[model samples]
Target: MTGTIHNRETFLSQIASSLGRSRLSSGVTDPEWKHRPQDQVLQDATPDELVDILKTQCLKIHTSLVITDAKKLPETLHEVVANYGGGPIVTWKDERFSKWGLEPLMKKEWPSQKLEVYEWDHTKGAENIRQAEKANVGITISEMTLAESGTVVLFSDKDKGRTVSFLPATYIALVPKSTIVPRITQAARKLRELHHSGKQVASCVNFITGPSNSADIELNLVVGVHGPVKATYIVIDDL
Candidate 1:
């Protein structure tokens, strides 16, 4: 079920032959660009400075941002869930929840509060999507956060359903301070490095900025046309 390209070598060979050039798969280095402005953008910003940039960008993207330490994360999450109208919640089956001290809230607090919670189950298949569609809130941890664009990078694997972010009424992203990168340039470089190191990257990588926004209808900006109407990012300061 993996998205591995079986005919990649043959396909590239055919293209190379058509172009009258040998397949240059080995000993080929990346070209150097003199005017690489993308690398320069926010390049010198510290993590704290990046957070500040992200905060400002969030304001532009219509997303709420909250800063809290690991110790306060559970409480902060609870408050956010309450504000978004306690769920029918859907979340990724990620271990970071326990690592960041949210196991209690996930196992006890939410259930005791009579909130219906569903974690993404790969085995359940369509059932997960059904739950996500009915969910009032969907929660996920950001693999990476882009400061300049206020974007959250989601590398979707089996346990992380894309529908969890797309179908819910509200979305909450848990962003670790360490994941706060200056921009997409750094994120792209990280992905490239992973590929070069022969690591298995996720089949789907989603770069989400705030909620679903579109200006297709009458050229007027519309929010939540195809996804969550409200989005919040909880930035963990000491995770």
Candidate 2:
């Protein structure tokens, strides 16, 4: 047991060091990969044009879902769901949806709406994705969201599996305002870091901006032809 422990620690340290060095060489070491400024920390939606964008996008999508930090579950999630037709709220084990005083609130807003609150364990990524796909909507917390391209980044590990975010019909991602970066290149650097750290690479890493759409044939646009038909994102001000 002692030898095994020593070997594992040694391996992890070596991997972390190599990953750090490689990322630095790849020009990923820069904190700001893009010149665009980080998105503003939005507290109230009324003033920000994002409100109109959110409303329009939500109405256009088939399913609207929101994934917020367990510590910062937005007060508006239930309201939005109720207005757009209620759907399930899939979360991770640490999300603490029940403890955050959300269950009762949702119950009140959507007395007749069915709420499927699932706790994700990373080992069950395959199962979780299957369940998320069956539902019309799915929401999961994100590591970070890029504002310029409207892309969301997800990392896989023991707690955050990949399926919950990628397989649903409409994916609602909750990202902290602080976690909002300017570009996908910054996100790719983070992924490279994770890869070098010897963490198990996710079977899937999705960077979703809008609804799953395709203009593959005749330049005619189509939605839900491949992935989720819709995606709604809420960048909570607080982490």
Candidate 3:
């Protein structure tokens, strides 16, 4: 959904007036920086190199990474679900699942395997959250994958509920190789491009890196404090 800041101009004007200055909407120039080290990091890396970087980062974040081609995606996904304890699964109502050849797994194979599955329905509203809470695993297709940070980016909308990734005990992200970027810098650039092109940006954009863990309680690492206990990313090599 498109969001607007109410009374934004008035609010800024009030602040400017209090400071005895007029709002400077023009004649402002961006400052030059001495160094742009961010641009240099992994600047010339190839797709294969990026994948290697992502795999390394995944290990540090305690996230499992599985790389497979399009032909083996179904089998890889099935193996991941089964390894995570054969879920009462919840997934986003994303068309990519079908486009990527998961229609059979979601519709026929999973049911025949006696796995319970639920898709996020916008019409159901809060019922979706309840289902997500009950699920052992929640699955989603990542809109963008950050190789440097091993982050899976999700754009939440009518079909993609925020709870699909937040509430489930285990979280699984289907990462398309084509969507992998160098880092958040590239991700932010893409978002800016979308906005400049007048596309509707998602209200909630999640940058999830592995499972939730906090060291708040006596400085000991505690997992699953606010979200999933385990996380995995199955990267499709030929999606």
Model 3, 1-239: lDDT tens digits are 67888999999999999999999888878799999888888999999999999999999888999999888888899999999998799999988788878886567465337788898899998899899999999999999999999999999999999999989999999998999999998899899999999998998999999999999989998877899999999999863
For model 1, the run of ten residues with the poorest summed lDDT? 104-113
In the range 1-239, model 1's lDDT, one tens digit per residue, is 65777998999999999999999967878798889999889889999999999999999999999999998898899999999989989999999999988886567465347778888889998999999999999999899899999999999999999898989999999999999999999999999999999998998999999999999879999988999999999999963
Candidate 1's C-alpha runs over 4 A off are 1-29
CA lDDT of every candidate: 0.92, 0.59, 0.90
What is the Å distance of residue 187 in model 2 from its true position? 2.1
User: Once model 1 is optimally superposed onto the true structure by TM-score, how far is the C-alpha of residue 105 displaced, in angstroms?
Assistant: 3.3
The collision pairs in model 2 are: 67-174
lDDT, candidate 1, equals: 0.92
> Which number leads on TM-score?
3
TM-score of each: 0.89, 0.58, 0.91
Instruction: Give one digit per residue, the lDDT tens place, for model 2 in 80-111.
Output: 55543555555555443465556653343435
- The clash count for each model shown is 0, 1, 0
Question: What TM-score number comes out for model 3?
Answer: 0.91
